[model samples]
Target: MIKITEKSECCGCNACVQRCPKQCISMKEDEQGFLYPFVDTTSCIDCGLCEKVCPILNPFDTKEPLQVLAAKNKNEDQRLKSSSGGTFILLAEHIIKQGGVVFGARFDTNWEVEHCYAETIEELEPLMRSKYVQSKIGNTYKEAEQFLKDGRLVMFVGTSCQIAGLKRFLRKEYDNLLAVDFICHGVPSPGIWRKYLEEIKSSRSEAAGKNTVLSLSLKSVPVITGINFREKQQGGYGWKKYGFVVQAKSPSKGDKNSVLLSSIFNENIFMKGFLANLYLRPSCYKCKAKNGSANSDITIADFWGIQKSHPEFDDDKGVSVVFIHTCKGKGIIKELSSRLDLIDSNLKEATLPNPVYFRSCQEPKKYSLFWNIYKKTKSVHEAVNAATKLTFIDVIKIFLRRFYNKLRRTFKMVN
Candidate 1:
């Protein structure tokens, strides 16, 4: 029987419990709020499905394909309100409408990322946005599998490795199951995210007030809302109901909030989709779902190249990128196409991703100590700060750099 010797090794994704045909495994939480797998010897068929599906045991295949597509996401309103494009929402809508249960991330009362179920398209709003923080999956797969066994359709989505991990656990496939996984980067543990949130809340205020879930808008420097948690019907959030959201900002311009410390990014503090690509679980960085080989049928992400390649696709706000890896994925596309507007750009035309984007989850130790430090980064605010700085020292440095570049160009001309 397989047992969790070190619980920290598990993210509580519950892949192992589902893969066992004998249904021998279950997850339980410990004092530190960590979850580990426990096996039921009575249900043990010993098929080794649990071991086979462990993302640690099997890594993703990272073969790059020549084609990728920039897609016009359906449900435009939700797309504009999404952490990224609302691809997952559209997929979830169809799944739930077909009487399937959708499983994804949500926050508990303490605002920690944890697993939850969305029975309808409406319930998805809270679950759809990217949390950026590492999600705690407590027996979701085991619960989802139970739902599947009773002949209920189910749709599950998460980072590619996670989706793959879920598939490996089930050991078998059913017609009612449709899985979607994202092209992930990595996920950070909740402990690290907790530290960062405390720092933000300390520097800012407890989330309150109209038009603000995080109350980030300072009257002295009113701008876009950041990480609003208020439900939309309550009229505080702009349009969508967001829960457990993370805000990435560009550096500051001389604002009172600006730190004297140097930061990256100009003064733009924008939410650049979900930060799943950042602070990943160690197994996720070395994920085995890189290629199209996982059990997940569909892959989703932002159509990064929509601006250049599919200019006609109308991202006026946002567009979703999609990869249909299997017949099941193709079927989902057909269903979605019927309900929403969609355009196609293969993997290649969408955009040529930077080297880091392709090798996002290659390894964990590959990062330096700086990785932990970078977790504190506020991207949008940093960009704004980078753009607005003109201190006395900066003036001299700019003048020198300009003069040196001019001299070098002149010398090259003469040569």
Candidate 2:
């Protein structure tokens, strides 16, 4: 029987959910909103297929990257919209151009993040920016496998666990498949996210002078009409200054609509809660897929140290640190050589800020207290503030770090 004794053992990959022959296993959400497989005892034949597909139970042999490079797409438009160097767009473009399909996470009409596939250039736009939420993977593994089996090239990009889940679900390797995983900090709780959205709605209604105050419950909020985490309205491509904005239909303002844009770090309650580790999935604190264990063909992330090592590549738009783990990844890079400006770079320097590459995120001592308060208050802001009371020194340290990075960028540009 496939059962999770410890929460940390399950990556929430959904591999077991999709691989069950009798359709006995289903992903059920716990109190924290993280999903785990539940086998229907009556239907389950004790086949152990679910256990076989569990990536955490049967780990893959880790393969070290063949080469590391810093790259950016030549297209200025693509680079600007991308969260990190538009490397993903370039890679996806290659597969699409070859009459193939690309799978990645994208926000749906209601602003909920989920994994889906794109076969055209237009569909790739939504997949450019980082969603920062744990995307629901709905049958994408099976869809990708079907495409590969049909002789169509397939490109899938996601966090390490997701890529590992796909590989495990497929059971066998396919030459037509290319897996690209990113250096992830962690996937935040979807249930917490729903609450956060409700918070936004409640605040917006209050601002709109509504006679009826919407309940501060996840079920009460109207469907989020729009969301933009990387809203550049005020920043003007100032990568350092970003905002998380959400739009909802206005009930009181006569259909004019309402918008909440929080540019300040302190005001962005959802972001603050996420960074404080108040509501991340328990498994994220001890990610089993880190350190290249996912066996992805290529791994990509922001080159955080670009200003110091490769000053020329530090254009403030975005730069990608790419690690090629297999010859197939190397060949893909070669094929896109004309579109990408690659620079041989040191992997150590590139991965300095991304700590998940080496180890999991350390659980804060206040983790339990934070969640307890969150359960009672149902307020993202109050919960985060209660959990992580940023002292004067802590605030100053954060300010100093941002100032130092900006100073370094300025100095590099002047010289």
Give per-residue CA lDDT, model 1, range 1-415, as digits (tens). 5666654255456677666678678766443223467898887877777778786566456544433445555656676666556677877887888888999987676667887788877888778666655676657877788999999989888766677677766667878888877766556556544544554444342222222333333343322223433223222332222323334332333322321111111211212212323234555544445666455777776666565775676544556667776677787777777655676566555536522235544532313322433334632223222334357987999999999999999999999
**TM-score of candidate 2 to 2 decimals:** 0.87
Taking the tens digit of each residue's C-alpha lDDT, what string does model 2 give over 1-415? 7888999899888888888888888888888878888888999898888888888888777666788899888897877777777899999988999999999999886567899999999999888788878898878998998999999999999989899888888999999999999998888888887776765676542223322233333334444566767654443634444456666655444454446443434456677777777777788888878878888999998887788888977787778889999899999999988988889986687778666786788888789888899789877667777788877988999999999999999999999
TM-score of each: 0.66, 0.87
Each prediction's Cα lDDT score? 0.58, 0.80
Best by TM-score: 2
Model 1: residues with Cα > 4 Å off, grouped in runs: 1-12, 17-50, 59-68, 204-278, 314-316, 354-358, 361-415
What value of lDDT does candidate 1 attain over all alpha carbons? 0.58
Which stretches of candidate 2 lie above 4 Å from their native place? 204-223, 232-234, 248-259, 264-266, 391-415
- Model 2: lDDT equals 0.80
